[model samples]
Target: MYKDFGPTKAVTDMTLELKRGVVTGLVGENGSGKSTISSMISGVYPPTKGTMTYKGQPYSPKSVLDARKQGIQYLTQEQGTIDGMTVAENMFLGEEESLGKKGIVNIKKINARSAEILKENGLENVIPTKMVDDYSFEERKMIETARALSHQPEILIIDETTTALSQKGRDRIYEIIAEQKAKGTAVLIISHDLDEVKHLCDEVVVMRDGIYINTLTGGDIEPHNIRQNMIGREIDGSYYRADYECSYDEEVVLEVRNLSVSGIFEDISFELHKGEILGIGGLSECGMHELLKTVYGALKPSSGSVILKKNGVQLKNTTVSVKNKIAYIPKDRDKESLFQATSIKDNIVTAALDKLKKGFIITPSSERKMADKEAANIEVKMRDIEQQVRDLSGGNKQKVVIAKWMANDSRLFIMDCPTRGIDVGVKEKIYKLMNRLKNEGIAILMVSEEMMELIGMADRIITMKDGKLSKEFERSAGLTESTIISAIV
Candidate 1:
């Protein structure tokens, strides 16, 4: 199939087939057209050229509902559940007639059904009657998975959905996929994590520059081989930091003293030093995410202070933090970090507006120069800076977020899952960038669910359990996932 957005060719002459009872994996670099192909197959977008055949018949869907009616369901990488709607409502949205008689909908019947689905999918704690907006990103993702599975789809497309999920949620998804495979359902999973693709997929297809690459099966489904085929090059084995020592300056940059956020976290005290990479790891509900946001001044603490040691100013809001040259890369890039409808240039230059302005007036050329320089510096794949950020892939959207902060020349970066949903190549770039930032004496407080990332990149690792610091490990060859997992679990 061929898909084009204006002059940009998202998917070019992509020919593919899914086999029943077989799990297919799609691996590609950012903007390499993995999601686009999945979207077309699920009827989210129409193909410009080429055609698809399903069950020995021509299949062309006009809309997502049309595709779902034909036993095809998709769960997108982005937030798929609607806010202000109950979990049950969101699950049975398009098919409410099944849960009602005549023209009236039976809310209780749907809620009970939704509850059963949630329990079966290992999300029994989620209240089906509660609004989806009240749940965390990870919970909402599992809820979306439940909704997709409720239909018993013949073809299921999981478009990078696991990137937002915690390990428990991911394991639940794996269980569901295994069950689906046993039922002879064809499953297509798109992921940047090569190991996940290797573990879950029976056959892996590679795509590059919107064109179809070779497909690997059996023993060929290795990380290095998949990485090379996706990026068209051989990446070094050492994709993370090489050092085994925890070294940083004696000067402290930010200090959190007795930080308490109501019931979220309490007595969270830590000192971030210059040139240090302080990594925080924990379960999705352990409150580390809220702690990072509180320190960044995005969340109001019940009692305690986050002070910038440079000037001894108490951090109270996002404006104050940004003005103090502190950057934040949130995990929920779409809703929390990016202005979806804005141009890439606008998004990048928004952070550097203070520097782009001369006195009180800012020129268009100055904005353009700053945006262009930072976007190119981060190597954001786009037709031009004028393109909307929502048009870019998940990894590219992350690049735009990093580029925006880079333009501001931030002194300290509070990154939450900085490499989440990004490809290995961009992850390598970010790891290298973090190293460079640390070498230049910039402090980094990174919160990641990926223990390997913390072990591989951090100078010091802190694990959180039940809203409290459980363990702190200094960087050494002895640091491993077992040590960290012991603290978290």
Candidate 2:
């Protein structure tokens, strides 16, 4: 398969095969054409070159709905549910004829059938009549999964779905995949989580720079080997920081006092010291995600305050936060961090607009220079800085997000799942960057669900459970995954 978007070739001469009764894992760095190939297969886009065959027959789909009618389903990384639509309406969106009679829709039968499907998939709490926007991100993703499975697709493509899900949600998806395999369905899964790929896939194909690099099977399906193949180089043994000593300053730079966000989190109080990486670990609904938003002033807290002290001056709310050198990299990078339709240069210079201003007016040359400097510093791979951010890969988009904050010279960084969908090569770069920032006396507050990451990179770890701080662990040689897992559960 070959796919091109204007001047950029997303995929070139990529060929692969999926077998029924087995899961085929597609592993690649961001912008590696993994999602592009999947999109072509699911009829989201027609290939610019080459042809596709299904069950030994020529296949060309005009649209995603057309592909679905032929038993092909694709669950994308982005939220696929329509905001105002109900669960039943989204599930049988285009295939409503099955639930209606003679040009008339039967809402009652649709709801009844949708409820049965949701119940079968262990989503008992989700009502078929309720609007999808009323549910959480995880719940909405489950609904998408349920909808895809409802068609009993012969070929199912899942693209980076597990990164947005918690362990419980992932387990449910794993069960569904297993059930599908038992039913002789061909599964094509794309994920940056190497461990997940190894666990769920029978064969793994690595792609880089829009081409296939290697295919791993049997004993070759190891995380280290997969990383090596994906990046076409050997990765360092130590992916995170190795320093065990406490180098943080004694003075607290930011303080959250009795922070409460209605029913999300209650009485959440914590202190971040200068030059420290404070890691927050918890389940999906444990309020850590909301806490990041409240601290950044994106969401208003019901009680308490988030205060940043610098040079004896107090800072609160987003305006002051930005002015005082505070930066936030949200969990939903696509929706919250980067403007999809804008250029990379525009996104990078967005936060640092004040720096690019000459007197009362903004200078385009100065903005371009600043954006170019930061983009080069982060090594963002792009044809040009003027390229649209939406056209770049997930990893490159994230680099642009980080470069924007770096350009602003942020002192205190609030990062939520900073490395969520990035590959190992990019992850190493981020960890090194964090270490460099720490050495410069910049404080970082990291919120992530990865236990190994917290244990490896955090100077101090705080675990939350059910909207409250469950336990705290200082970085030491003795810190283990089980020690943190106990608190998270």
Candidate 3:
């Protein structure tokens, strides 16, 4: 466990051994120090105290490159790739010098080499000639896997990197892990998806906030137990929002008509009441994302219009969507959300700049006050408002992002995958906040991959398949995981 963020420390007086040909999962919350453990093992950072012995030999890596030389490869939580460069260029980034022959950078040789590497790694579909920017985050990660495989490492370290992947991409990574296990190479994986940890790992190591809690092997470990250990408490009900009834029975606050986006969805329509929590469920590619984007005006609906009535006035574009008291929180808090380089104050204030200014002159005092207030409301764990957002973990960063838009006093909100990578502790707070907003008569439109969330939080769950509404379930009675799964698939 990390004692401090900067002078990070691995767990003290702790020892655990991973067997060869076995997969071991490290599970914890966002700042529970699991990633710190992985980083120390992978040589991203060495422990302040305590020595790591592998194969009965004292081992310490001065840098990531040093760790790679010792046959240990790390795939970071973030997908590391150059945007403008070709896939081949990124694959051989630092190792290009080794691939070079007689001080010559052979473009042809490298391209062919990248192609061969991808083919060997079961990713021949990703062309070496294609620009890295052209590939999705999952595709790029696969390319990175191929690159790591080319290094012929012994033990592979998969940091919490799989959440960015699609199902197919995740399957490919699983296959890679299996291949390495067959070779008797030890596997260490870190993940927030508890199901993934259970299925992939032979043994599970659970960590609480900055502490090594417990370790359990196959048959001995249970999912509920693991979750409890991670949170350090017993939880009631679902991870999603608590049950509540709609308070308003008046006219629809938002209406969509024939909303269609090319390559996304077809003519679809829906209405949201002024105070209701609506859940949209679909398979990974069932246009749920497009639906949320359309409502938030993030994507221009090809032929349809989202007519939002606020105090009997209609508004269109996202600029007006906000003006009409609508707010949307995206799923990818790291990517399409938080401003990492700026302070917490900046990220929170940037969203509502107009509120902090007197005509054209901005007030720093007002901005700081607003930022502090929002942070406090969201319970954002940070040292101070001046603290850079980059230092915070996934859960805290997401809280800051939520604070930004919620500060706008929106009447209607659309949240897309808001709880993707966070842990249950932060998740509970988010659920409580949603309930508070719902009680305040704010309409909520949410799309979540987790069925348990839909089953618990939504007043009504709408299932979509192939761009059409497949089914709808009311919260009045008889809603379960099995029921939602049946409707979704």
Candidate 4:
């Protein structure tokens, strides 16, 4: 199959088969045509060349519904559930007629079915009648998973979905995939985590630069070999920091005192030192995300304050946070971080408005210069800075989010799941960038669900449980995930 996105070739000469009752994994770097192939197979776009055969018959779907009718279901990388709609509405979005009689829809029937599907998928906590906006992001992702599984598809394609989920959510997805495989359904997964591929895939396919590389089975599906095939180079066993010391300056750059948000998190207090990478980790419902938001001034705390040492005033809002040189990279990248409808240049310039202003005027040439310099520094792949941010892949979009803050010369960063939904190569770049920030006396407060990420990047790890602090671990060569897991669970 061949697919072209305007002037760029997304997929070229790619040919593969999804065998019945087998789970196949697709591993590739961002923009390596992994999503493109899945999109083509799931009928989001038609291939420019080559044919697809399903059940030994010519299969060409003109739309997603056509593919769905043919028993193909795809769970997208981005948020699939729509806001302002009930869970039942999103689950039966295109098939509402099936729940209706004589042009009138049966609301109770739709809710009942949606509830049953959620229960079957171990998401009984979610209320089907509630609007999708009422649920947290992780819950919404699980709802999307349940919607895909409710179809009883002949072929299932999940694209980078697990990275956005918590460990519990990911385990549920693994169980669902196993169930589909047992039911003789062909399954395809596109993921950047090699460990997940090794866990779930029966056979793994590698792609690079829109071309098929090789397939691995059994022992050949290990990380080192997969990394080599994906990037055409050898990566060291330890891609994280070389040092194993808990080192940071004595100065407290930011301080949170008795922070509380009703029903979310309560009485959270911590000090982030200059040149420190303070990691917060816990289950998805632990309120660590809300803690980060409160500290960044995105959410007002019920009773307590976030203070910067440079200016002794408390941060009351996002404007004050930015003015105090604080940058926040949200977990929901597409929705919270980037301006999806705008160009990369514009997004970058938005962060550095004050810096680029000249006597109450900001010029386009200055914007272009700052945007170009930061985008290139981060190695964002694009035709140019003028390209829309939505056009870039997950990894590049994250780079832009970081680049904008870099353009602003922010002294403190509050990142929630900084490397979520990103490829390993890009993750390495971000890790390196974090280290650079630390060396320059900048502080980072990172919140992540991935235990390994906190273990690898943070100088000190703080664990949260049930809306409160559970434990704190200092960085050491002996620090392990088991130690942290005990605190989280």
Best by lDDT: 1
Off by over 4 Å in 4: 102-104
- Per-residue error at 127 for model 3, in Å? 1.5
lDDT of each: 0.92, 0.90, 0.80, 0.91
Residue-level lDDT tens digits of model 1 in 1-489:
899999999999788889999999998998999999998899988899998998999999999889998999898888999998999999998888888999799988999999999898778899999999999888888888888887789999988888888888788888888999999999999998788999999999999989999999999999999999998988877789998999999999999999999989889999999999999999988999999999999999999999999899999999999999999999999999999999999999898788887799999998889899999999999989999999999889999999999999999999999999889888999999999999999999999999999999999999999999998999999888988999999
| Candidate 2 C-alpha lDDT tens digits along 1-489 | 899988889999899898988899999988899999999999988999999999999999999999999999999887888988998999889878888999788999999999999988888899999998899888999999988887798999999998999999989889988999999999999999989998999999989988988889989999999998988888868789887765699989998899998889999999999999999999988999999999988889989888776564444578878888899999989888889999999999999998877789998888889988999999998878999998888888889999999999888899999899888878988999999999999999999989989988999999999999999999998899999999988
**Model 2 poorest ten-residue lDDT run:** 308-317
lDDT of 3 by residue, 365-419 (tens): 9989999999998888777899889777788888988898877777788988777
Give candidate 3's error at residue 1 in angstroms.
7.2
Native-referenced Cα lDDT, model 2: 0.90
* lDDT (Cα, 0-100) at 172 in candidate 1: 81
TM-score of candidate 3 to 2 decimals: 0.91
Per-residue error for 219 in candidate 4, Å, reads: 0.9
lDDT of 4 by residue, 225-300 (tens): 8999999999977778888899999999988999999999999999999999999999988999889999988898
Candidate 1, residue 279: CA error in Å? 0.8
Clashing pairs in 2: none
- TM-score, every prediction: 0.96, 0.96, 0.91, 0.97
Give the poorly placed runs of model 3, Cα more than 4 Å off: 1-3, 6-16, 237-248, 311-316, 486-488
Model 4 steric clash pairs: none
